[model samples]
Target: MIRLDRDGPVWTLTLDRPDKANALTREMLVQIRDAAAEAEQAGLAALILTGTGKVFSSGADIDAARAGLATDGVWEEVSSRIARLPFLTVAALNGTLAGGAFGMALACDLRLAVPGASFFYPVMRLGFLPQPSDPARLAALIGPSRARMLLMAGQKIDAETALAWGLVDRIVPREALVEEARALAEAPVAAPEHIRRTIKRMIRG
Candidate 1:
């Protein structure tokens, strides 16, 4: 499930499946993709992705994955859309980020985490590989060695470690996470829209 809220130039998309740890189902992924598309069309200055309750996302739904209904392509598409958005994008990790959800967080232009938040990549443990774009983008942000530690060794790093490793731009208290993200978003609004969009495209490419 997803919830979209708009406040001035910022649009926030919240993963709303607390009972399931915000684990994404195929339908949820589709909804996210559609939401990203909508945000792009709306010409919003910033987009913030967050989750309800404690967990940011537990990744794809296991049952859906077992049935072959949830595929890497779906997540790849969603992350790609978010990456290509022509405005500032932020991943406000309210809690743990693991599995395919890591790719989504990595795709954002900025990442903010709460003090106890952590990052994990479980592909090696699950006997699967991440979407092709995931590793490259992740490595670009945190370097190849640390990326390997996460993707290959399944290392889970807490907020401070993530900040030191350059995985997150900032770590704020849980209650201040959203406010800090909003402030970051607001700061970019003074830049020319075209310049921001062009720079983001250049960086992503």
Candidate 2:
């Protein structure tokens, strides 16, 4: 399930199925993709992605994956929409991030995680190529060799190691994750849209 919350100009999109470790079904992925589009259409200041439980996402729902969701083009579309958004984007990782779910976090401008979170993408071991945009984004964040560690070697990295490798920008306590994300967005949210867009373009260009 997916829940979108608005606080003034900042919107937080939460993955709400804790019982399943927030495993994503195709419907959930579509909701996430639609939310990203909605944020851009509304000219929102910031968008924060987070989840309700101790695991951000266990990746695609097993049943859905077996039904071909694993290689679905919707994954690329979702991450690409987020990556192209001009507003500040943050992935407030409540717990471990795994599998195909890596794409969304990688597309975000920043990623923050709880101290206990771990990161991994088992695409290779799972016998599926990752979503098209994922490898490039992953290499851009944490470097090719380290990207290889996760994607190729199938290693699970702890939060501290993730931070050290640049996979996550900061490690925040679980209780404060969303609050910290809002704080980071304060400036961008308050700035004029043009100014925010300009800075983002400058940095990303």
* Candidate 2 segments whose C-alpha is farther than 4 A from its true place: none
Indicate the TM-score of model 1. 0.94
What lDDT score is found at residue 82 in candidate 2? 99
| lDDT for each residue of candidate 2 in 76-115, tens digit (9 for 90 to 100) | 9999999999999999999999998999999999999999
Please list the C-alpha lDDT of all candidates, in the order they appear: 0.88, 0.94
Which runs in model 1 stand beyond 4 Å of their true positions? 202-205
Question: What is the alpha-carbon RMSD of candidate 1 to the true structure?
Answer: 1.5
TM-score of each: 0.94, 0.99
Clashing pairs in 2: none
Give the per-residue lDDT digits (tens) of candidate 1, residues 96-144.
9989887779889899999888789888988888977899999988899
Candidate 2: worst-modelled 10 consecutive residues by lDDT: 1-10
